[model samples]
Target: MRHTFAELFAPAIVLVFSSGCTVGPKYQRASVPTPANWETPQPWRPSDPKDTVPKGEWWKAFHEDQLEALEAKALDANQTLKAAVARYAQARALTSQAISALHPQMNVAPLAQRQRLSGNRPTSGVPITLRPVTQNSFTLPFTVSYEVDLFGGRRRNIEASEASLQAGAADLENVRLVITAEMASDYFTLRQLDSELAILDRTVATLDKGLQLVTARHEGGIASGLDVAQEETLLRTTQTQATLLHQQRDQFEHAIAVLAGQPVPGFHVTTQELSGEPPALDAGLPSDLLERRPDVAEAERQMAAANAQIGVARSAYFPSLNLFGNGGWLSGDVTKLLNVSSAVWAVGATAAEAIFTGGARRAQVKFAQAGYDAAVANYHETALNAFREVEDDLTGLSILNDAKTTQQQAVAAARRAVDIASDRYTGGLVSYLDVVSAQQTLLSNEQQLAAIQGERLVTSVLLIKALGGGWDASSLATARIKPTIKQALQP
Candidate 1:
């Protein structure tokens, strides 16, 4: 039995592809030295029996309902996160575009034309008069083409595109981490301000009663007018502080609104006093950062992409093969366009190689290698920065915890002093200025404690972000695959 040209070439094509001559060095992750333990000693250890770090919704560790809702809303509505997600989608599309080179490309074109030939135009060897100058022609053609990846340049391109998509996925996770952490930080700060305002409001009421008492005493010729004036001045000052706290609260509220992708005028969080200790976060071994941090994962994926680009560049050193086939029907009678008598077809192949281009190809290979090296360096830098962040937050939380303890003691002592000073002034043993000083000291201490608590919460969120915000590197493998609709919906 006779075979068509396509059938005859099939075995040769398979043999060439099966040789698997990938042009560049196989990819291996760049080696990075990591410490066996974190730089800062952590009081907390991973609760998981497997010693793995947290994954998925790390914010739930705080156990705050309002915070959980805010984080959820931010994930759903944040514009930055939406943009990152769109970029990931684009990367996935580009990867598919690159992969398309691995398969045959088919397209159809149908043509109908009427044209007139010039009667005076030259003909082959001898001139002849043109007859029936005007004519109608109709054809419908189907063409298929395939590039045989003999040296794997197109394969490397697909590899690079897949790696880029992985990097994009990691970037999306990083954005989600940032938005959620920002929302939590802003929420905590706003709550802290609310607590401070409540403290000031209570202080103002106490001063109000003191002012009335002193005013009555002055009118009865028992207390001096100077005492009444001092009490009034302290009350107004405390009120001013309340106003300041409200101002801070307003700013944080607006920031939270932006994070939640809501209009500032429409978004409002009810006044809830700050009340929570920073949850203990486990700092796993430094090596864990390779898998834990999304930024680090992104850096590593980009390095892989750059490495694949080197392969693509190196493959340019070899020749390329393109196979093409055309099948069509042509007839003067439009109704007979599909008839066997009207069939026309062609099959062919082209081999191309760049014999010389100065040093452009060599320079491209060098440039790709340089890019890979840079990406490797960036990966290392990202890991080192992650370690530094975890250390900073750990130390800050530890010191802040101690400072909060001391400030609470100070607040207690200041409260006792205010009580004792007020009794002494009532007994006419000291001027009311002593009581005012004690009250001011107490308010300062309380506000300082609240501020420290807010700092600890913010640091905790930062630490979570630095540690990779509940995403693990293992997910990169899954991300390389086209995501299902359910997976696409995930934040």
Candidate 2:
């Protein structure tokens, strides 16, 4: 018995030490090319190199206290984000479970039974006899089973699970970034509507006063009925515009309510004009984008997981070793079950080799390798897309900046023209039609300016989002809510 135990334990120790070799190809991160400088022309480069937007708080740059509060509320209450968090936790638990395969499994069994043996036997050289024997038996057994990871199959599985968990965490961060960006965009849009509505209200009031003056002049026989009719037409048009603005504002208000995770009827945001300058974004070099972007990180993690899966698949070509042992006592009587004299022990080793698989094993290995290749390609593509988004936002910001400047000048000129046309018509130097045309031009330019302002703000938020919401390695480690393996394993 002692010799048997020694032999079994020896192979287990050897197997433990030899489980270090991981089969299949080692994973090397695919290199991504970085551009030296932004392609877009800039009026000013990053002004403060040291003053960067911190990870997880990029939205604070807008300097809107209300926006910050709404973002916080969404992060806490949004159902989609909560589901992502739960999925991350599940991945973490799966990682832990995969790792546990490297350890031994143990179980205990205790049994008691009473049996009666009836003897009516005709022995080879003896006469038949009838008798009954009663006996009580008790047995306590225990087992220890350990799978010897001879080819590192279990280890590779654990590695894959760990990488998957990391990907899940990155995905959760991505969800948060998306949610925050959406909230900011919606909030800014609602504010833009408020500004437009305010403009329409004032325009309507001004047109009404102008119509009253024109009517008084017609009553005094100084102005023709044509002038009164033109004035009335302008007033009605401005009122119609105000009605349209009100409808737009109401739709945006309802959207904001949904984004804030509130019932539409219970949620309300007061009409407030958009007043702040667009927050400036400091997009670092392209290489920085790869490290800072959560989606890119997620893709890299997926590649790593695929690489590990290849190892797991290749391990199937080798033999598997397992060690099983049990030691306990058995006695005919319950009173003597724990006695040393009733001791018993057993230990064994099992080795299995897949001699034939009809090509299934080879196919699996090829499949795993193919998956790894696909993952690498996907990761590279994701990185490229991230760069494209940053470049596009940068170009958009530069072009929109120039457009805003031109539009501002145009608005000023139109405003001045409206004043000149109004004065000319009152002095009988120009027709009422000229005044109407000037007012329409000014109103159109002002509306375009409002839209441009909203675009600038929305683009700024999008740029921040593309930059991965300021996420970094440090933020991953410091997130307030972290996924736990134990929490994931719960039923």
Candidate 3:
């Protein structure tokens, strides 16, 4: 019997549609214990899901143009963030690798060689000739192979790879969030130090003047030598503290330069006291956490990948089909290698099924299922932790807001005490020691107030981070694929 090439392949082509249904169980999104609203009992509103333009740049809400600029530069230049993007692109490439399996793989080889036949070689105890025969050998061969994907194993693999690619995308966004948050926190801490330094500067100046006054009084016999010694000690101690502050500020400056991808040695941020009240932020609904949090989205995508892997594993139980074809021409004369009489061709298929294995196939299916369960557990844990962070940041901001006001009043009262003590010391009603104690108290209160103010700003930044910095999962959903190198390189 003879058959046409198309006729021979008709059954395999039909198997692609008929028996090629994906072998693994369909994936369902993992269930999550979503809350209707935030647990914190404060004035908060849900994020608008319809707001197409979510806070792509949430840092701008603080209204600091300098901060916004720094964030922009970090996004463009930060090495660590760039590494995350490269990893995402790598996953995209792997997805393409998996898809290539669906199509036939082809190869061609051309050869030319000279060979000498042993004419006197024994065959059936007969010698053809006593003389050697030399001949030219020329050959051309072509081959094709295809895995039929009859049980959908290749399709399942592609599904798994695609899910992993989306996970990479989410990871990219998560990295961006982490970097931006770090930059903001570092920037704020540096500004906080600036405010503290300003307070220290003023205290140092006051102590210096007080020391001069005491030294003059002692020289004229109006004040004790002990008063002069004590005043000098306080002034010198403040000077030492301010010197330490300068060191701390330099470290933070170096950190900022690294984050901005700049050389650290000459980098400097001008000393400016921290200003601007913490912005009022809305704590969106707990359900919004799924859409907004990139970590959450990443965990969920992992679950999908795991689910598809189960199908790929189960497909091992089915028979594997492979189509193979090889054709070649061979001739003693190179010029005639392409002649019809010198041509040879062949085509066929193989369907292989393991009749017995040491339970390896079963073990693989179990392994895949375990992976899926682990992914589900991770997803739940991630959501729970996200909720905890939001509540903690909200409580911190609330308590710190109250502390700032009380601290302001304490600083005011301390200043009044210092003024009264100075007057009394000059009028001989109190010793210079009493004035020194008042000055120390006032300085401490002022520093405490500055710290409280800085704490408020820090807490606000944390809250913004906990809220996912205005991210939305829909952006990942609509992406068909990062097909172009240009798209893959972009964050």
Candidate 4:
């Protein structure tokens, strides 16, 4: 019996050693065409390549202490981020479950029964037969089953599951980037509104004083009633604009509260002007984008998982090998269940091959291959889109910078025009209509300048988000938590 067992074990050992070669096509990182430099010139040079962007905390670039606090609060309290974390946990659990397939499964059963034999059945062979026999028995049995994985099918499944788990992690990071960007945008927008409101308030005050001057002049016969009415009209218009700005500011405040995971009714931010300059960023090389962007990394990982699925599908065409064994004690009497003579054991190997499946295996392989192809395409597309976003944002920032410069000059010129028009109207060198036109131009230019400044800041945040918010592949390497296969299979 020992020799026979050795022979069986020898063949199993050989099978295990030979199973290292996986059958399906191996995955290669898809090749993509990338440019050496961005089409738009970067104002800032790249930072130290060895220096890492603080992972999981990219909002500190704004240098706003309040913003930093708000981000920490949002990370801890936001419902959307919490949901993402839950999804990541679920994926990790699934990965562990898949890895468990590499190990054995065991079960135990303890049972008791009572039975009676028919009297007529035992009397056939005997000339004189007695009454029916009644018996009670108890048994304890243990069974174990294990798949040998001689074709690497289970290993491929495990690899796919691990890749999916990584994808989930990337998705979670992507969610964080999006949330932070949105919060920053809204915060800056609220500040812009406050600035606008301040400008409107001052404009209204000046217009009120002008209205009084026109009224006094009309009483002295130096100005007409029409001039006073126009001045009043300007004051009322400025007041109306201030009212609209207040409404906008309220809405933005409510949005910020929601983002901070606070109740709108209980949350409010004090009115403050947007005073910070836009944060400078070093746009890295185009090639580095593949490793830096979270969504791009996610797409690549999904492609790897899909490639592994093809291996799993192709495995269906091969035979499966399983080993099973069970041992127990059985007896007619419960008290005699532990007797050595009552013991029994079983051990067996099963080999199953698909004889015919009406081309189902072929169809499955085709489907899996198709899925892999689609994933590859999606990965390439996502990478390209990421590149496009960076380029577009770079171009936008450069152009907007120039626009801001030119618009500042325009604002200065408009202010001078307003001052001169006021002086000319008092000296009767120009009509009151000229003064109104110059004042309107000055207000519009100033508002545009404020809007452009806010937009530049918001776009910078978006650019940071597109760059994966200072996260990269190195972060992924450190963040990975290896899963245990053996513990997961215990039953």
The top-ranked prediction according to TM-score is: 4
Model 2: CA > 4 A from native: 1-19, 43-46, 114-137, 474-491
**Model 3 Cα lDDT, one tens digit per residue, 5-86:** 9899989877664467778889998778887876665422443444222377988777788888889989999999999999
Q: Model 2 over residues 207-276: C-alpha lDDT tens digits?
A: 8888888889889988889988987888788888888878887887787666667788978777789998
TM-score of each: 0.91, 0.89, 0.89, 0.93
lDDT value, residue 25 of candidate 2? 74
Model 2: per-residue Cα lDDT at residue 20: 57
Clashes of each: 0, 0, 0, 0
Error of 4 at 373 (Å): 1.4
Name the TM-score of candidate 4. Answer: 0.93
Cα-based lDDT for every prediction: 0.85, 0.82, 0.84, 0.83
RMSD of each: 4.1, 4.1, 4.2, 2.9
Worst 10 residues of 2 by lDDT: 474-483
In candidate 3 the C-alpha lDDT for residue 455 amounts to: 80
Per-residue error at 290 for model 3, in Å?
A: 1.5
- Scored by lDDT, model 3 comes in at 0.84
- For model 1, residues 1-491, the per-residue Cα lDDT tens digits are 99999799989878976566788879999988887876666634444543333578888888899888888888888899999999999998898778666667778899988778777666887756665477668899999888888888988898999999999999998888888888988998898888889889888999999899899999999999888888899899999889877888999999999999888997899999888876766666788878988889999999999999999999999998888999999887788888999999999989999999999999999999999999999999988888889888878877887888898899999999999999999898999889888988988898898899888888888888878876888988987654244443332
- Please identify model 4 stretches exceeding 4 Å from their true place: 1-20, 44-54, 119-132, 478-490
> Which segments of candidate 3 are over 4 A away from where they belong?
1-19, 42-54, 118-133, 478-491
Count steric clashes of candidate 4: 0
